[model samples]
Target chain A: MKLTRTGVFTIVVALAFLAVPYAATLLGSNYVITLATRVAIYAIVAVSLDMLVGRSNLVSFGHAAYFGLGGYAVAISAFHLANDVPIFGWAGTNEALIAWPLAMFVAGFGALIIGALSLRTAGVYFIMITLAFAQMLFFLFVALKYYGGDDGLSLSTRNLFAGNRITDARTFYWICLAALAICLLLSWRILNSRFGMVLRGAAASERRMAALGFPVYRYRLAAFVIAGMMAGLAGALWANQNRFVSPDMLSWVRSGEFLVMVIMGGLSSLVGPVVGAAAFLLIESYLSGWTEHWQMVFGPFVLLVAVFAPRGLWGALRGKGDV
Target chain B: MQLVLEQLLNGLQLSLTLFLLAAGLTLVFGIMGVINLAHGSLYMIGAYAGAWAAAKTGTFWLALPAGLAAAALVGAAMELLVVRRLYAREHLSQVLATFGLILFFNGFIAWSAGRSPLLMETPPQLSGFVEILPGLPYPAYRLAMMGVGVAVALGLWYMISRTRIGMLIRAGSDKREMVEALGVDIAKLFTLVFALGALLAGLAGVMVGPIRSVQVGMGEQVLITTFVVIVVGGIGSIRGAFAGALLIGMCDTLGRAFVPMLLKSWLSGPLADGLGGALSSVIIYLVMALVLIVRPRGLFPVSG
Candidate 1:
C-alpha cells in the first residue's frame, strides 16, 4: 500500500516510541521511560475515543467509566486472588491472560448498556447522559468498601505476562507500546473498511444513512463497544503499570483529559490521538515541574487550541488546506 | 409520616436550587445553541464571590448581590470573549471550548482561594428554625430558599410570557435570524439572557453556600444534576426545567432517605447501605434515562 504523509509520520512516530526505552537508558533517566509508558497507555484511550468522537461524531463525556472499569477489573481480581477470597462467590485469578480479556469484556459490556441508553439521545443530551452514567459507576466503585471504597485498591503485584516479569520499566513500556500498536493497526483497518465508511456516513447524517438502509444505531453501538473495549485494554495496562487503581481513574475529569488529548491530536486523522496524547503528557510533565498552577496556563492553551485549531495538531501539521 | 414530610421538604429545597441552575443552562442552550460545560464554573464563581463577600461584610444580604454581580460580570465577559465566537461553531467545538473554560475557572479559583473550602455563615436571623407543621420545625433558611425559588419561577413566567423582552427571547430561541431581521439586536438579547442565567445560578450558589460547603469543583457536582434536570424537563423549556428539577430532587432525596431502610429487611446492613447509597445517587440518572426512553425530547419539549 502507498503511504501518505500522515501514514509515513505515523510509522516514524511508532518507531520513535519503540526506541524510547533505549533512548531513556542512554540518557539515564528512568522517569522518561515511565512518562513514555504513560503516554502510550493514554494514547490507546485517546485513539479509541477518536473512533467515536472524530469518525462517528459521538462525543462521549464519560469514557473514563470504561477505562476505570478495566482498571478495577484487574485490581479487584488481583485483590481477591491474593487474599484467597471469593468475591460474590467467584474465585479471582491474577493471571494477565485471564484478567486482561476479562477487563475488556467487562468494560465492553458496560459500554453496551450505557451506549444503548445514551445513543437514544442526540447532541447535548447524549454528552450529559454519558457523563451521568460514568458518574454513577464512579460512585458505585466509591461505595464498594471491600475494594477500598474512595481510597481505591492496589494489586499485590502486576499481572504476570505468561510468567514474564513485567515489573521492569523497559518491559512494561514495551508491553504498553505493543498494545498501542495493535490498537492503532486495528483502528486503521476498521476506519478504512466498509464498516468504517458506514460509521462516517452515519456521523455525517444519520438520517441520510438511515434512508440508505444502514442500521445506524446498531453501528454506533458497535463502535461504542469497540472503543470501550480498547479503552479498557489501555486501563488494564495502566493498572499493571502503576500497580494501583483509584476511583480517580474513573472521574469525569479523566474522561475530559482523554477528550482533550483527542482534540489536541487532531480528530480528523487516525494518528492524531497518539500525537495528542504524547504532547499532552509531555507538556503536562514539563509544565507541572515548573509550577504548581500549570493548569492555569494549560487551560487557556487548550481553549486557544479548541477555538483556533479545531482541526488539532495533526490537522495543523497536515496543513490547513487538507482539512 | 413526619420523616417522609421532612424528606419531601428537603426534596423541595434541593429542587429549587437545581431549578435555579437548570433554568440558566437551558436558557443559554436554548437561545444560543451552545452547550456550555462552563455553566458550572459560573456557579463556582458565584459561590466563591458570595463566600468572599460574606467573609468581608458579615452580611448575607450584601453577599447575595455581590455573588450575583460577580457571576453576571464573569458570564457577560465570557459571552463577549469566548462564547461569541462559538455561536457559529458545532456543538463539539462548543463543548470543548467550554470544557477548557471549566478547567481555567477551576484552576483560577484554586489558585486564588487556596485548596481549602470556604466557610459562609448563614445570617443569624435566617439560621433559626421555624415551625412549618404542627410538630415539625424546619430551618428558616431552607423555607426562605423555597420561597425565593417559587417567586423566581413566577417572575420568570411573567417575564417570559407577558413582557416584550421575554417575547423577544422566546422568538430568538425559535428564530434568531427572524429576530435579527426584525431590528432586535440579537447579540445584546443573547448577552442579556446569558447574564440573567448567570445571575440566577449565582443567586442559587449564594443561597446554598451556607448549607453546602463552598469549595472548588462543587459546581461540577451540582452541574451534572442540573443537566439531568434540563434533560428530563425537555431542553429549552423553563416550565420543563421546573418540573424536572422537582421530580429529580424528590426522587433523589427520598431515595437516599428510604431506599436503604427498605432494603435492610432483605440485605445485611453494610451491603444495604452500600447498595442504597449507590442506588440513590443514580436515581436521577435513571429518571433521566427513563424520560429519554419514553419521551426523547423531554416531558415538556417546547415546539419551535
Candidate 2:
C-alpha cells in the first residue's frame, strides 16, 4: 500500500483534474472544463492504444475506427429513439447504461473482425492493413445517407444517467473523470496480472510465446478487443461531449494523433497515455490560439521530441527503467 | 463496350499516376527500411512548384523540370536534415517524425501559397482529343501522360538492371553491410536513392496537377492509396508496385463507374446508390485484405 513516486505523481494529477471545474468557476469561463473533459476522453483512447503499442508490441494505425464506431453507436441510438422506430426488434433508448455499453460492444465487435484479418500479417503489413480497414469503415459511414453520411449525425440530447439527464459542463467533466479513473484502475490491474505478463512476453517475441504454448494470437486478439472497447467508450463519451458524431472522428489523421499521444506520453504504463493526451491537447490549443499556422511550430516540436526525447516527456521525467 | 473502353483508358491513366507515386514509396521503404509518411509532401511540393512555374512562365514544359528540381532539392534537404537521423531508429519513431514532417510541410505550404487550390492548365497541343478508334476519342493530354509513364517505367527498369548505379542499388538493398565494406559510401547511396524517389514523386505530382486541382493535403489522399498499392504489391518490389497500382486503379475506377448502375438493376434507388457508393469506395481495401489473407507477404515480396 506504500506510495511510489509515480503513485504520488498520479495522486497529484488526479487532484488537479478534480479541481478543474472549481478553477473554471473562479475564472468565470467553462472552457477549461470542456477541454479537460476532451482530454479525459482522449486519455481513455490513448491509454487503450498503449496497451497495444506499449504492452503487446502491436502498433495499430487505425485505433480511431473503434472510437468513431463508439460515437456512431451513440448517435445512431439517439437517431432511432427520436424517430420512434425499432431497429432490429428493439426500440432505441437514450439511457447511458444502455447506449454506452452498446457503443463499446459495437467497437469491440469491429475490432474482433479487423483483428482476425489483420493479425495474419505482422510488421508493416499489419500496420497498413489495420489502417485500410479503418479507412474502409470511414468510407462506409460516409456513404451511409440515412445516418447523415458525410455531414455527420447529431444526438437529440445527452443520454440520461440513471433516468436523469446530466446537464452542464461540470457534471459532464466529473463523469468523464470518473470513467477515466475506472479505465486506468482496470488497465493497471490487467497489466500487472499473469495475463499481462504473457501479453508482454508475446510482444517481446511472438515466436517464443507461441512455442511456450501460450496461444499468442488469441492473447493478442483479446488485448485488441479490450483496447477497442476502451477506445469505444472514449468515443461514446466524445459523442456525448459535443452531441454529435462525424466521419472525421475516424480519419487516419486522428489515429496518427492518438499514436503521437501514446508515444509522447511515454509508452508501456497506465499513466503515460493520460499524460500524453493532456499534453497533446493543451499544446495544440495553446499553439492554435497563438497563430493560425500552429502545425508549422507543432510539427517541428514533435520532430524535436522524436530526435531528442525519444523516451517521451514522462519517460524522460521518470529516468531510466522507469516503465 | 465503348463506355468500358473509355473507363479502361481512364483506369490506365490513374494506374500510371499511382505507379509513379508507388515506385518512389516502395523504393525508399525497400532500400532504406524507412517508412516515410512525408513522401506525399514531396509530391505536393512538386505540384505546387510546377504549378507556380507554369503560372509564371506560361509554359508547361518548364514546369516539369521545375517540379522535379524542387522536389529533389527539398527531398535531399529532408533526408539530410530529418530522415538521416532516423536511419537507425525504430519504425514507430520514424513514422512519428515523418508524420511531423507532413504536418509541417502541409502547414507551411498553406501558409506560404494561400489556402486556395491552384490550377494547372494542360499544355496546348496535348489539350485536344485524339481519335484512337473510329468512334472513340480520348484526351490527348491523358495519352501523353500514359506515354510518359511507360517511358519512365522503361527508364527505371534500364537504370536498375543495366547501369552501375543500378547494380549498387540492387546490392545495397540486398546487403547494406557488404556493399559498405566493399568501399561504397552507404550514406551517399541512401541520399541518392532518397533523392531519386523524391524526383519521381515530384514528377507524379506535376503530372497529376493538371488532372486534379493542385491543393494542400492532396498528397495525403493519394498517399493512403499509394500505401494500399505498396501493400498489395510486395513492399520494395518495383514489379509488385506496378502490378499493385494497376490492380487498385482499375478496380477502383471500374467499381466507381459501374457499381451503382449494377446495384440499381437489382435494388431500390437510394439503397442501391448508397450501398454501391460505399462498396465501390472500399473495394480496393477489401482487395488488399483478401490479398493479405491469401498471401500475407503480398503478391511479390522481395525480402525472401
Candidate 3:
C-alpha cells in the first residue's frame, strides 16, 4: 500500500517495458518488438528459477527441462490436431485454453517426478542429478522420430489465443508482457507469504527449519513444482513466439543460460531477473551484430560480471542496502 | 562370443578415458570444494594442442607431451587468474564463474580452430591389431591405452601413498587450515594438484583424439559422463572413480549393443531401435539415480 523506493522503481520499469511495443512501432522496427518479447519470455523463466535458486536455496541445473517440456507439449498437441491424428489414444486440441494449461500441468508433473528423485540429495549431487535427468529428457525427445526428432516440430502459425490473431507482433508482445507481469506479481506474493518465509528459513538453515518441525522436503518440492509450472508457461509463450520447438530448448546449455540470467540480474531481488534478461538479450543482439563470433565477447563479459560485479546490474543500480 | 568380447574391450577403453577425466575432477572438487564446469575446456584444449602438434611434427609421441604441457600450463594460469578467487565463494558463484569460462573457451576454440573438427592419425606403430587371447584380436592402440591407464593408476596410488606432496594433498583435503598451519604453501600445493589433474585430462583427450572427432565441444559430452562417474564412485576417492568408470562404461557399451537386439523379438525394428537408443543413453543416469537413493554420499565417500 505504501510506496517504497524499490516499489516505485519496479513500477517505472514495468511501465517502460509495457511501452516498448508502442515505441518500436513509432520507430517502425518490428524487430525491436519481437526482441523485447523474447526478453519478457526469458524473464518469466528467470524469475521462476529465482524462486528455487534465490529463495529456496535449491540450485537446479535443469530448469530448461521443464521449459522445453512445455514447448514440446504445445508443439506435439498442435501437430496431432493439425494432422487429425490421436496421440496415445487422445485427440489433440489446438485451443489455447486447453493446450496452455495442459502444457503447464505436464511440466509441473515432470518437475514432481524429477524433484522427488533429485531432492533425495543435497548440494552438488542435486545439481548433477537434475542435469542428468534433463539430458535424459533431451535424448528422449531426440529419439522420438514421430515428433520431428532432431529437426524439431514446426507450427504453421501461433496457437490461437481465444480466437485472437496472435500473428501480429505487437499483439504477441503484449500477451508475453502480460504473462511476465502476472508471474512476477504471483512470485512477489508467494515470497512474502508464510510459505515463502519457511522456504527462506529452510534455505538459510535446513537443519534448523527441520528442527523447528517444518517438513522441509515437502515445502521445497512445492516450490520446485511451482517454479517448474511458471517456467512451463514461459515455454508455451516461447514456442508461440518462435513458432517452433526443438531439443535445444531443453538442453543443459539453456539451463545454464537461465542460471546466468538470474545471477546477472542480482539473485536477492525480485525484479533482478527481468532486468538481467533484458540486458542479456540486448547485449547479445548488439554483439552478434558486430561479429560472427559474438560469444567470444559475450562469454568474457559474463565472466567479468560474475567476478567483478557480484552484486549484478540491479544490485549495483539499487546501491548496497536495497537488496 | 567375439562380439561380446569386442564390446567388453570397448567398455574398458571408454572406462579408462573416463577415469582419467574423473580422477582429476574428483581431486579438484574434493580438495578445493569448487564445482568446476569448465574442467571440460581443459580436455578440449589438450585435444586441440595434441592434434595441432601431431600434424606439425608428424609424430604421435611428440603430441602426447605437447598436449599434457599445454593443458597443464592453461590449467595453472586459469587457477591463478580465476579459480583461486572462487575457493572461498559459494557453489553457485563457482558454478557461474566456471560456466563463463566454459563459454569463453568453447568460443575461443571455435574461433581459433575454424569451427571444424580436426583430424588426428594414430601412429603406424600402434595401428595394427594384436592378439590378446586365442582367436581374439584387439586394436593395438586401444590396448596401449589400457596399458597406460593401468600404469598411471598404479603410479597415482604410489604417489599419493608414498610421496611428500601426496601427503600434503591428502592432509589438505582433510583440513585446509591445519595444512596451512603446518607451514606448507597451500596455494602452491593447490596449483600443483590442479595442474596435475589437468595433465591427466590432457592425456585422455590426446589419446582419444584419434578415436573420436577432435571438435570444439567434445569435452562437454565426456565431462557430463565424468561427473556421473565421480558421483557414483564417491566424490573424492580415486579408487571409486576407477570403479565407477568401469561400471558405467560396461553398462553403457553393453546396453547400446544388446538392448535393441533383445527388444527386436517383441517390437518393430525402427521403434525398437529408437527405444533402445533412448534407454541406452539414459542407463548411466538411471544408475546414478539408483546409487544416490541407496548411498547418497556415493559408494566410496572419502572422509574430509
Candidate 4:
C-alpha cells in the first residue's frame, strides 16, 4: 500500500490534535485544550452527518436530536446517581462504561423510531419530518422539569472510568481523540463495505437499486442508526467536557450548524468533516473574540462557500481531480 | 361554553396568521423549487420595519403599509441578489444559502435594534372589546385581525383563481419551460411572486406586532410552526396550507386550553399543569406525526 497525499494530511492533522494538550500546558492556558476537545467531539458529529449527506444523499435537518439525547442520557443518570434516587425502578450509576453505552443506545433507539417514520417520506418531507421530530424531543426535554427544564442539569463531576474519574484534561482529550479515530475508522470501513455501496447506490438512483433487488430502505435505516449512535457518543463526551447539559444542545440551530460544518469542510470523504469541524470552531472563536456580532461576518462567509466553493475547503485545498 | 367559544376564535385568528406565512413559503417552493430557510427572516424584517414605522408615526395604521413595503422590497432584493442564483442549484445548496441569509439578517437586526424587543401599541379604535355573543365580549383588535385574515384569504382566492397573474402563476407551476417559451419573463415573475410572498409574511408580522413583542428571532419560531403546517398541508398547495393551518391552529389553541384541565382529573395540580403545558406544546407535532403516518405526502400533495 502506498502512502497517498490524504494519508500525509491525516497524519499531520492527527499529530496536531495529539499535541494540543502539550501546547496548552506550555502556553499556560487550558482553553486551548477545551477548544481542541470541542473540535474532536464536533468532528464526530460532522462525520456522522456526512454518512447521510455525502454518501446516502439524505439531508437530515435534525441530527442534533441524537446528539442531545446522548448528553441527556449521561446527565440524567448522573443526576439520579448523585441524588441516590432510583429512576424507572433501577438505580443509576455514573460509570462511563455503563452510561456511555446507555447514551449510544438511547440515541440509536431514537434514530430507529425517527428514521422509521421519517424514511417514509422523501426529499423535503424527509428533511422537515426529521426536524420536527427533533423539535418534538427538544420540547419533551424542556417540559420534563425534573431534569432542570430549560435551565438544564449539571453533572457533579465527570463520569468514573473503571472506578476512577478521568479528570485530567489531557486524559479526556486523548480519550476523545481515540473515539474520533475509531469513528473515522468505522466510517471508512462502512464506506468500503457492501452496505455502504448499497447506500451510495440508492442515493445515486433509488429505483435502480430497488430494481437490482436490494433492500434499500433497510440499508438506509441501518446507516441512520449507526450515525445516530456515533453522534450520541460525541454528545456524551461533550456533556463531560462542559459538565453541564442544557436544552440548547438539542435546538434546531445546532442541527443547522452541524450541516454547516459538514458542507463547509467537504462531504463524504470521512476526513472532510474533521477538518470542517476544526475550521468552524477556530473561525467562530476568533470572530466572536473580535466582536459580539460575529455571525454577521460568518454568515456572509458561509454564503460565499455555498455560492462559490460547492466542494468546500477540503475540495478546494485538494486541487482538481482528487475527489 | 363562553371560554370554549373564545378559544375557538383564538384558534381561528392564529390559523389565519399562520396561513399568511405558509402561503408565500409554499408558493415559492412550488414555483421556484427552492427551499428558502430565510423566509422567516423576511417575517422578522417585516415586523421590525412595521414596528419602527408605527413607533415613529404613533399610528398602527401606518404599520400595515410600511410592513408590506419593507418586506416586499427586501424580499425582492434578496431574490435578485441571492435566491435567483440558487434556482438551478440543489435543495441542499438553497437551504444552506438561505440559512446563511437567516444568520446575516438576524445578526443585522440584533446589531441595529440593540437586542431589545420593540413594542407596538394597539390602536384605540381596535383595543376595546366587542360583544360577539349576547354576553361574551371578544377583543375588538382580534376581531379586526380575523376580518383582515378573511378578507386577505378571499382576496388571495380571487386573485389566484380569477386574475390573469393567477393564470400565469398556475401555468408557471404546471409548466415552467412552456411558460418561459411563451414570452413570459420568468425572472420578473419569480421576483413578483417572491415579493408578494414577503408582503404576506409582513402582513402577518404587522398584525402580530401589537399582540406579541416584535423581536429578532421571533420569525424562527413561526417559521418552524409554519413548516409543520406546510408538512401537514401539502407542499405547493394553497388549499393544503389553509387546511393544515386551521388544523394546527385549532389543535394548538384548544390543546393548550383543555389539556391541563383534562389532566387535572387524574393527576395532582402541579404535575398536571406542568405535564399538560408540555403536552399542549407538542400536540400539534403529534398531529403532524399522525398525518405523516396516515398520509406521508401530506393531505393534498401537488405532483411536481
**Interface CA RMSD of each prediction in angstroms:** 1.1, 1.0, 1.1, 1.1
Q: Report every candidate's CA lDDT.
A: 0.91, 0.92, 0.90, 0.92
The structural similarity of chain B in model 1 to the true chain B, as TM-score, is 0.98
Candidate scoring better on lDDT of 1 and 4: 4
Q: How close is every model to the real structure, measured as TM-score?
A: 0.98, 0.98, 0.98, 0.98
lDDT of 4 by residue, B187-213 (tens): 999999999999999899988999999
TM-score of chain B of 3: 0.98
Off by over 4 Å in 2: A1-3
Candidate 1 error regions (>4 Å): A1-3, A320-323
DockQ of each: 0.74, 0.78, 0.71, 0.73
What ranges in model 4 sit over 4 Å off? none
Candidate 3's displacement at residue A57, Å, is 1.4
The order of the candidates by DockQ, greatest first, is 2, 1, 4, 3
- For model 3, what fraction of the real interface contacts is kept? 0.52
Q: Residue pairs in steric clash, candidate 4?
A: none
- Residue A145, model 1: Cα distance from true site in angstroms: 1.6
Model 3 chain B — which ten-residue stretch has the worst lDDT? B269-278
